[model samples]
Target: MSLSQSFIIGQYVHRNSIIHRLDPRAKLVIAFLFMLSVMLLNSWLSYVLSAVFVVCVVTISQIPPSYIVRGLKPVWLIVIVTSVFHIFLTQGGQLWLEAGVFSIYEEGVIKAGNIAIRIILLLVMASLLTLTTKLGDLAQAIEDLLKPAKRLGVPTQEFALMISWTIRFIPILLNETDNVMKAQRARGVRFNSGNIVRRLQSFIPIVVPILLLAFQKAESASLAVEARGYSPGMNRTQLRTLAFKKLDYQVLIISIFCFALLLALRK
Candidate 1:
């Protein structure tokens, strides 16, 4: 299944590989550091290095490259649009194309290339995070990390629960949408055989069912939580605690090294 279409609801492939076993906190921090480095990078050489790093991380995770690429396919259009805009609208150096009020420059092309690479790296990093970490683990890690915020009068536990539920429900919602589409197709609803407006109108039936299903699920979940003694202003213990392992320390060290290297290069 295409990563974009797959219900994000399944158990992530459990692996004892380096990427999978690292602490979620470490992974989150490294992701942020990697993104920061990518943003700081301006040269093609740096971008190439970043791409290699991403490839190494992806390989270690042992997930299919097709899944990663497929997830990125949905956003390809946006990337293209942004690239085109930057290539034509960004002003620098000598113009390559000049017509009336429109122009494209060599510098713009370079800028566009850099921007596109940065975006792709960002997507890869995000996909890596999702692929390697289970939704529950991510939630628990977030809650633990945000525990200090509780002293500042924030509902960290409740907020964390909401995030956990949202991530867990994404795949379920996608699956529900797929089922709705299949049923509509079986009922002779031709999704692709109409004008833009007609196609949109056809989606009404599909959307309504999905929304109703989501509402029902939400209601059930709420009741279930209440029955389980879930209270807003009470302290709760976690079943699966997250701990920083040796690999997490190694990852943090590597991130620090990369950040320092990037800063040195920038200098």
Candidate 2:
């Protein structure tokens, strides 16, 4: 996958829609529930209903469907490989194709289709969350959610900070990779139209520089944090505070209701 496509995975896009305006905590809660409901899905009917709900939410969020689809382009190969595995490796329920010891069953095809849809839904929903919420707000929300674990000596703030840094660095690394690849390409390195081994070899120049850059960036980040007098366990204040509002409550209730309906359908 190109770095441009990889860059979209965790990068946040600013917008002024309902999903963008909701408290990050509320959005996180609903996304968590929605993911659980999607994983629980089994039948075609359940998947159809879930897809409908996802579309409705995406429509309301006001993000272009094309953008969401583009974000998923990088993962299409993995999704296809997973679906193929399910289709061929699964055994039982009246064989559709048989060759020697290998057999493709009727059940396998359906199972593969279901698994592919489930994965796509999961990615789309996650992308929606990242696209609508700011990284700082997401970090704060994660910290708020993990606050209870601090009683057990967990480093909630540090974990939240790590999460925030991770999201922040994704696009940085991707852009760096793109730059490295373009430099290599300029020197007549063929990334495409090569055998698997040759293609892997072509990436060596790109990978080494990326690792060095990553370490350098990490050191710089550490120094910046220390210079700011950041202590591991110290209380930190945010410029913006998160609070739940009427819209958040309404969205939560509706999300929970839909999740319940999905569960009931699955049962």
Candidate 3:
């Protein structure tokens, strides 16, 4: 698939909307808390409420729902695998099916359903953050959040910078892979018209070029860093400052209150 056809996971789309305007730190905190609350939930009603919250946020973000759905397609396999494991391995409730030595229980099915929903919710929430916030903003917010760790000699800034670059390069690597595959195809390399071994071999031609390109990019990045005289633990100035506004606090309060109410209802 071409890069355009590939999923956009960590790329930001500029839009003037409540979600897009919120502070990145607030978005990060809210999404993390929401996912954690979803994990603690034990009822379908709670999951429904979580889903509604996610849909509402997406609507506020002004990002196309189609984009979100397309982005989720890449992760559907993971969600399905997680669901299948839960469905077959978990045991409890009424027996729904029995064939030979295998049996399906009602509780297992319920667990599977819950797991699937949770995975989708987490993906949607995470995608919302990256779709709305810029990578630089996210990195700064993370560094600020982890600033206290600096006192403990934890290299929080480096950690945050590494994470930001990793996220920023996800789309780049996918695009590079697509380009490499196309180039290989132009050279009469058939990636799909072969047996298992042949197909595996086809990837070798594609993988080598991408790896070389990746190393070149990494080396260039390192040189750029040194050219800028970047020093670990040195005081640096930010081009943009992050500050929490009244709207940020209001949204935080409302989200926390709603999530707490849902958790209470689950009891």
Q: Pick the candidate with the highest TM-score.
A: 2
lDDT of candidate 2? 0.88
lDDT of 1 by residue, 1-267 (tens): 433264222336677788998998888788888998988888777777788888888898887787777667767877899999999889999879999998999999988998898888998887688778888788777788888998999998889789879877777777778888889989999887779899889888887899999999899999999998888989888787778777789889987797767656652
Quality of model 1 by C-alpha lDDT? 0.81
Question: lDDT (CA) for every model shown?
Answer: 0.81, 0.88, 0.87
lDDT tens digits by residue: candidate 2, 1-267: 667665476777777888999999999999999999999888788899999998998898998888888888878988999989999898779878898977899888988898899889999988888889888899999999998999999999999999889878888888888989999889999998679899888888888899999898889999999999999988888888788899999989999999999999985
Misplaced by over 4 Å in model 2 are none
> For residues 132-168, could you state the per-residue lDDT of candidate 3 as single tens digits?
9999999999999988888998888888889888888
TM-score of each: 0.85, 0.95, 0.90
Better structure of 1 and 2 per lDDT = 2
TM value for model 1: 0.85
Segments in model 3 whose C-alpha atoms lie over 4 Å from true places: 1-5, 187-205
